[model samples]
Target: MSSSAHSDVAPIVVSDVVKRFDKVTALDHVSLSVLRGETFGLIGPNGSGKTTLIRMLLGLGRPTSGNISVLGRKMPSRQVASRIGYMTQSSALYNELSIRENLAFFGTLYGLRGRRLKERIAATLSLVELAARADSPIQTLSGGMRQRVSLGCALIHEPELIFLDEPTVGIDPELRLAFWEYFAQLNQRGVTLVVSTHHLDEAARCNRLGLLRFGRLLAADSPDALRARSGQQDFEQAFLYFAQQAETAEAGEPTPAAEKEA
Candidate 1:
């Protein structure tokens, strides 16, 4: 669970990022940085803007304000797109295509071809435990199996940074554990990961976590650090403690700490 040392430049950096849909603010001055070779979790309930922020980082959506840079290049940089991989919350697989064919398509899109593409596709399939189903049609697979295919597609190019949005959704607990182990292997090999998930226990497995509520960040730190700061025994309790503090502050009331010392 040790992360590789980071360089001067972070893999993903967000500064005062804001996204608004008319009057609804999806992100409000959101800011954080993800280091290389670490798994950073975005933990929040639904509608907390995790997906919106991830879209901006991937250059799929522009922030209404502020900045985001990935891999030392300004975002939406097509030149560096090949070095980044994204697994969206929804399955993006082609229902009519076989797993191998889907891999081939995505690989070609990432400029992989010929022998190299074949080798990469094979490796990715094995990595996700989908090698046995390589030729199976996407429509024939179960929800979890399909998710694995989507993951394999993203890793086909061996990207340096990956963004996984709720990757463990619909996956069984045992399979989810296996996926986390695979993520550790990727991190050990110098791949950075930005994972958005609502599972608090999985969030605790990350090297660092950003806890979000109502489109605002309540805290950003190691899970253990957050637990210590909030004097809580678990990640969920720590989150609730911070969230309550945020609510009280917004109401101009004394925080829990001030109330404790008073």
Candidate 2:
């Protein structure tokens, strides 16, 4: 496809993807498409395969079965690596380095250099609200501060797509709100974000959400749509409704809602 046409396609497409490690299934027949310039949330509890799916999307791992296309390229495509950003659940930063140094280092890995690198570092620091602490060593920063720096590093290269695995985990509510604000700005700038988060409240901020459970996607739609479908105004209650429906289907019983449609 031509570059322009490719840009018009969905940034992420996972088709019947299954990931396994020996007998353990991390992902099971999952499929979803993430639209361009939208924040797509993977909403599920821990061990629900959010991280596994993100890894596959980032080309760090391949599905045992089925396929994944990122930025119009197949799984594990090096050609699209530079165009994607990933903020891991764990700390991937150098504790000994200053925040500025960490951003510069990661930016260099993305082929940023000299003047451009310096500019990005400055811009990212301000974006994450860490400009004042840019000279502080990572080890000396608080957990929330460190998280901000990690986000800066991920965004230093200004990628078209980004995958954040539980980016707000362990942070204060105030900082979490700040992070989401930064994410909103990114979306406004046409960056596609795939964020895996267990926080149901945070999931509401995304343009759309995929409710995952036991490595299976129960439903993919807007938060309001999910709530409306489940007849629950509460997000948590809505998720439970879907979970129950999935369980019923697995047991070869049709859900009441399904029976009503028949």
Candidate 3:
């Protein structure tokens, strides 16, 4: 396809993807698409395969079956690596290096250099509100500060798509709110974000959410739509309703709502 045509495609497309570890299935025929410039949330409890899916999307792992395309290119493509950012759950910064140094290091890895690299470091620091402590060593910073640095490093390259794995975990409510504000600004600037979180309340913030359970995607839609479909105003209750429906269908039993409709 032409480059412009490729650009018109969805940022992420996963078709019937399955991931396995020996006999254990990490992802089971899960499929979803994330549109350009949208905030897509993967909502599920731990071990629901959110991290596994994110790893595949980042090209760090491969699905045992099916396919995934990221940024109009097949996953594990080096060509798309530089155009994406990933903020892992754990800190990936160097303990001995200063925040500024760490940003420069990650920026260089993304093929940035010279004046441009320096400019990005400054801009990233400002964006994360860590300019005042740019020279502080990673080990000297608190957990919250370290998380901010991690975010800065991920954004240093100004990628078109970003994957955040529980980015707000372990942070204070105020800091979590600040992080969401930053995310909103990124979305306004046309950056696509794929965030995985177990916090049900966070699901409402995304443009769309995929409810995952046991490595399967139960439903993909907007928060209001999911709630309306399940007839539950509470997001958590709606998720439970979908889970029950999936179980009913799997057991060859008509769901309560289906029986009602019939």
Count of clashing residue pairs in every prediction? 0, 0, 0
* Candidate 2 lDDT (Cα, 0 to 1): 0.88
Clashes in model 1: which pairs? none
TM match of model 1 to true structure: 0.93
lDDT of 2 by residue, 1-262 (tens): 3275255689888888889989999988888899989999999998999999999898888899998988988888788888889999986899999999999899999999999999999999989988898999999999999888888888999998999999999999999999999999999999999999999989789999998888888899988888899999889999999999888877785532221100
Residue range 61-119, candidate 3, lDDT tens digits: 88999999998888877778888999998978999999999999999999999999999
- What TM-score against the true fold does each predicted structure earn? 0.93, 0.94, 0.94
Return the candidate ranking by TM-score, descending.
2, 3, 1
**All models: lDDT?**
0.87, 0.88, 0.89
> Counting only residues 3 or more apart in sequence or on different chains, how many pairs clash (N, Cα, C under 3 Å) in candidate 1?
0
Evaluation by lDDT, superior candidate among 1 and 3: 3
> What's the alpha carbon RMSD for model 1?
4.9
Models, CA RMSD each: 4.9, 3.2, 3.6
Estimate the TM-score for candidate 3: 0.94
Model 1 worst lDDT window (10 residues): 253-262
Give the runs in model 1 whose Cα sits over 4 Å from its true position.
1-6, 253-262
